[model samples]
Target: MRKFWQKNRKTSLAFLVAALLIAILWFFFWPLNRVVEAPGEAVNIQPMVKIQGKQPLKQNEFMITAVSIAPARPVSYVHRLFDPHIDIQKTNDVTGGQNNADFNNVQKVYMQSAINNAITVGFQHANRPVTKQYHGVYILNVFPQSDFKNRLRPADLIESINGQQLTKSTEYVNYIKSLPKNAPLKIMFKRDGRQMMVSGHKHDIVKGFNGIGITMIDDMTIKTDPKAHIDPGQIGGPSGGLMFALQVYSQLTQQRYQLKKIAGTGTITSDGQVGEIGGVDKKIIAAHKSGAQVFFCPYVKPTKTNLALEPGHQTNYQVAKATAKKYAPGMKVVPVTSFDQALNYLKTHQ
Candidate 1:
C-alpha cells in the first residue's frame, strides 16, 4: 500500500496544481471582465411637487415631470482588478461583482472637475448672474446652445434676485418664474469677495413660463481638520452637496438630520431641498451597497423626452435599475422635492 501511494504522488500533485491555476484565473479574470463589461441603459422618472407663492394672494403652482438619468461611461473589468482601495475579490463575492474603489474614486474626481468646468464656462458667456467681484464661483465653460451661458459660473454664490435675498435654489427658480414675461430682471451675486449685479430679460421657452437658459451650482466648502488631509479630487458634483451640507450643518450646529443610519445623494440648492441629480441609479447603488436604506432622488424631471437625452444619462439609468432590481428590491427609493423632504424622511425613518 505504501509503495502504491508513493508511485501516484507525482500525478496527483500535477492535477492539483492545474486545478488551482484554473480556479485562480476564473476568480480574478473571468469575474472581473463581467463586472467591467456590464451593459447599462438610461431611464427617466418624473417628480411631482407644489410651489407656493411668496405673496398670499398669488396662486400656487404644481411642478410635475422634470427628471432624467443616463449612463455616462462603463467601468472596465481591468479597472476593477487594479483598484487599490477596495478588495475586488471580496466585493465580487458580495455583489456577484463590483467596480474597484480606487478606479471609481479617480473617475469621480475627473467627472466632478469636468462638470464644474462646463458650468463655469456656460455661465461666463450668457452675461446673466454676472458679478464684478470674483466670488468663489468662476465661469468654467459654456455650451453654445444652452440658455445658461454667462448666467452663472462655478464658485459664485447667489446673494439675491431683484430686491429679494436668495437663500435657496427654489427661491431663485421661483424668483425667475415670478418675473413679468420678457421683463428684464435684476440678479445680484457675489464674485471673489465683492457683490455685483447682472440684468437680463426672462425668456419664455414654454407658454406662460419665464426662464433664463442657465444652470447654476453652488461651490461647496470642503472641511478638514488639522489632523485630516483631504484631496480636492474627492470633491465631485453638487449631487452630494446637499448631504454634505446637512452633515456639515449637523456637525457645526446642534440640528441633527439623523443621517448616521441614512445615506442620501442629490444636488443641493440654497433653499435646502434635494435637487435631481445626474447619476441617480449609480448613486442609489452606491448608497444601498453602503448599507443605506432610504435613497433620495432629485425632484426635477426632463421637459422634452429626446432633447435632454445625453449618453451619460442613458447609461446611468440602465445600470442603476438593473443593480437595484438585483440587490435591494425591498429598499425604499424616495424622491425628494427639497432638502426639507430629505430631512423629514431621515427624521421619520430614524
Candidate 2:
C-alpha cells in the first residue's frame, strides 16, 4: 500500500483537487427546491405616488419595505444558517405550484388591488370622491389541464366570455356555470395592453361545476377626484399598500409624517384596515438599514381562540420588535392593527 501510494500520490492529489472543485461548483451553482427570503430595501414612497392637482406634502419620508426572495443555492443555506433573519421556503409553497413567471404575475395583480384599495381608503378619509371602475375579471392562475393553459396567462384580463361582457369575477363564474360541461368558450382577453382572443373548452374546475380551469379576481380600479397616480414600477406586491395609503392620505390632508424617516409593511384593505404581511423581521432590518426612525408593523391582539388555532404563533409586530431588539436596537417599532391606529400613532407619538 505504501509503494502504491508513493507511485500514485501526484495523480491522487490531482483527483482530490478536481473533486473538491466540483463540490464547490455544485454548492455554488446548483439550484434547490427552496428560496431564500432576506432583507430588501426601504423605498421612499413620495415620488412613487403622485396626487394630481394637489400640492405634495413636504414631509420627511414615508417608505415601503420589501423582502428579497431568490431561488436557494446550497450556499444560500449556509447564509441562512448564519443569518437568523433569513428564511428558507419551499419553491412550490412560495409560488403556489406555479412557475416563477406565474408567481410574479399574481404578485402584480395583488399590487394593483392594493393600489386601488389604498386610493379608495385615502379618498374616503379625505372626503374626496372615489368611484370603482371595473374593467373585467383578472386571471390569477391557469391550470395545466385547461384548454387555454398554453394561450392564457396569469396576468391576462378576461374582458368577455361568449360575446358577453364581464365586469366582475362573479359575472364570469355565473356565466361559466350556465354553460354545459365541456362547452366551447370564446374568450376575449387583454394581454400586455393588447386585446387577444382564444377558443377553448371549459373543464371541471370543481368536482361537478364546469368552467375555465383558472382562478381569478375582479379587475377594478378606484377613480379618485383630482386623480392619484401610483406607478409601482418593478415593485410588485401588496406589502406596499399601507405605505402607499399613508402617502396618499398625507398628501390629501396635508398632514406630514412626524418622524424623519418612517418605514412600514402591511396590506391595506378597502375598509382602511392594515392587514398582516410576511417578512416583518426582514422588513425591520431593511428599515433600520435605511435610517428609518420608526417602523409600523401589523399587529393582531392574540386571543385564546387565535392562540388555540396555532400552537405557537407570534404576530408580525412581535417578530418585528424582537428583530429590532436584536439587530436594530436604535430603531423604534410600532404595532398597528389598522390604518387609523398607525395614523394615530404618528399623531400622538410625535
Candidate 3:
C-alpha cells in the first residue's frame, strides 16, 4: 500500500507540471483582440529633409515624435496591467477593421500626404515658389456594397474612371454623379506601383447620385523651386507634419533656430494650420525621454460642432502639458494653433 501511494503521488506531480506548462504557453501565445499603444522614439527631422542646392542645417533641434502601436497578445495584457503608461485599445478601433498590412499601407499614405502638405506650407512661408500638381484620386476607403470591394483597397491610386483621366477627386466624383444609375464603369488604378484595372457599376452612394462605392481624396505634389526630399524611413503617420514643415522652413530660409532641443507633434495643412493629433501623452513622454527641452503641441478653440460631438474633450496641448509636468517637469510645453505660431515661437525664443 505504501509503494502504490508513492507511485500515485509521482503521477499527480507529472500531470500538474504538464498543466502548468500549457497554461504558460497559452498566457504568452494566445492572441487578443486588442492593441497596445506605448511611447515611441523621438527622431531628429533635420537629416530626413534634404533640399537641392542648399546646405543642410548644422544643428538638429526639431524632433518628430511617434507612438508605438502593436497587436496585443496575452503577454501584452500582462505588460499593460503592470505599466500604467501603456494604453490598450480595441483592435477594431485602432485599425478600423483593417488587417495589419492594410492599416500600415494607409498609414504610409497619410505620411506621404503630410509630407506634401508640409512642403507646401514650408515653401510658401520661406517666400519660395511652390506649385501644386494634382496627380490622381487616391482611394481611401471602400464600402462593402461596392462591386470593387475586394479588388480595391486603401492606398490604391485611381488614375482614371471610365478612362476619363481625372486629376482631382472632386472631378472624379462629379463625373460619376452625372452618370446614369447603375452605369458600367472602368477604373484604372495603381497598387504597389503596378497599374491595375477593375470593372464595376456605379451605385446610389448618395442622394440618388451614382458613385463607385469608394471614398477618395486628391493625390498631389508640391513642386518647389528648390527640390526637397523627405526620407522618413519606416516611420508612418501624419503626426510628424509640423516638425517636417519646421525642418523644411528652417533649411530653406537658413534660420538658425536650433538654440534648444525642440520637439513637437501636430498635423500640418497646406495653409499652415496645425491640426491636433492622437497620442499626445505618449508623444510627450517620448519627447521627454529624448531630452527635448521644449515641446510644441496643437491648441485651438473648439468649434461648436466639435464641442457638440465630444463633450469635455481635452485638447492635445492640455494633455501634453499634463504629461510633461508629471514626467518631465523641466520641459516647457508650448501651445501652437498653426505652423506660423510654432515658427514665430521659435523665432522669438531664439
Candidate 4:
C-alpha cells in the first residue's frame, strides 16, 4: 500500500494543480454575466466639441455634463453588491449582442450617436430649416437571444421591416408595437453596402409583449447648414445633444451674451425636441461639481415615463432637481420638454 501511494503521488499533484488553475481562471479571468457601474465624473462639453466655420458672438462658457461609467468584472460585481452607488447589470443587458463589447464597434456607435445629436441640434437650434432625408435605420446593438442573432451585424442598416420602409425610429417602434404576437417578420438590411434579406420569429420582450429585440436609430441626412460643424473628439452617446444644440445656437445665430454657465443632458432631434437621457443623478452631481449655474434636464410626464421604462425609467428632471439641491444648492435645474422651453427660459433668465 505504501509503494502504491508513492507511485501515484505525482498524478495526484498534477490533478490538484489543474483544479487550482481552473478555479483561478473562473474567479479572475472568465467573463461573468454581469457588469458594474458607479457614479462617473461630470465632463465639461465646451472644449470637447469644437464648432468651426463662422464664429458668432462671444459669451460665458455654456457646458454640458456626462457621467463617468466604468464596466466591472465578476469579482468587482461582488464588491459592488455592498456599494450603494455602484450599479450591477447583466453583461448582455449592457452590451446587447454577444460581441457588442468590441471596444471599436461600441466606440463607432457612440461617435455616430454623438454626431447625429450634434448635427440635428445644430441645424434646429440655429433656426435653420432642416430637412431629414432618411436612408434606413442603423442597427446599434442586437440584444442577446434575439432572433437576428448570428445573422445581423452591428453596422447593418435595416432598410425596411415587414415590407414597410422606415424613416424614423418612432415609426419602427410603433410598427412593431402594432404587430401580432408570434408572427414571422421579414427584415431587409444592408450589410457591407450589400442588401440582404432575412426572416425571423419575433421575441416576447418585456412581460408578454411581442417585438424584435434590437436597439437602433434612424439614419437620416440633416441638410440645413453645412458650414456649422461640431467636433465631439472621442466622446460619444446622445446624452450631450441638448448641450451641443445650445452651444451651436449660440454660435450659429451669433446670439453672443454673457449668460451664466449652463450644463444639460438630453437627446435632441432636428425638430427641436429634447428627449430624456440616463444618469441624471450622477450628472447633477457632476454639474454641481463643475460649478454650472443652470442645468437643463429633460421632462417626461409620468404617463410617458411608464411607457419608455426600458429605454430609460427615471424622470430626469425630478432626479436632477433633487440632486442639485443636495449637491449644488445655488445651481438651477430646469425642466424642458422642447428646445423652445429652454430657449424661453434662457431669454427670461439671461
Candidate lDDT (C-alpha), each: 0.43, 0.86, 0.86, 0.71
After TM-score superposition, the amount by which residue 218's alpha carbon in candidate 1 deviates from its true location, in angstroms, is 7.3
Give the least accurate 10-residue stretch of model 3, judged by summed lDDT: 303-312
What is the per-residue lDDT of model 4 for residues 1-350, given as tens digits with 9 covering 90 to 100? 98899879978999999999988777766665666666565555555444556554446566766655455555776666675456677766665535544534555665566556666666666657656677777777776557987687776888888899978778888898788787789999987789999999887766766778888877766556545455666566677777777776766666655455777888776567888877787777777777778888998886764656734455777777777777689988899988778778887875
Ranking by TM-score: 3, 2, 4, 1
lDDT of 3 at 304: 69
lDDT of 3 by residue, 78-140 (tens): 797887679889998888777778878888888998999999999999999999999997777
lDDT of 3: 0.86
Global CA lDDT of candidate 2, please? 0.86
Provide the TM-score for each candidate, comma-separated: 0.39, 0.83, 0.90, 0.71
Question: Tens-digit lDDT track for model 2 on 76-184?
Answer: 9789778887888988877878788877888999999999998888888888999998889889888776888878988898888899997988878888888888899
Query: For residue 135, what is the lDDT in candidate 4?
Result: 75
TM-score of 1: 0.39
Model 1's lDDT to the true fold?
A: 0.43
Candidate 4 wrong stretches, greater than 4 Å: 1-33, 47-52, 56-58, 73-85, 102-114, 141-146, 159-188, 192-197, 201-215, 303-314
Q: Distance (Å) between predicted and true CA of 295, model 1? A: 1.7
Model 1, runs deviating above 4 Å:
1-137, 144-233, 255-259, 301-323
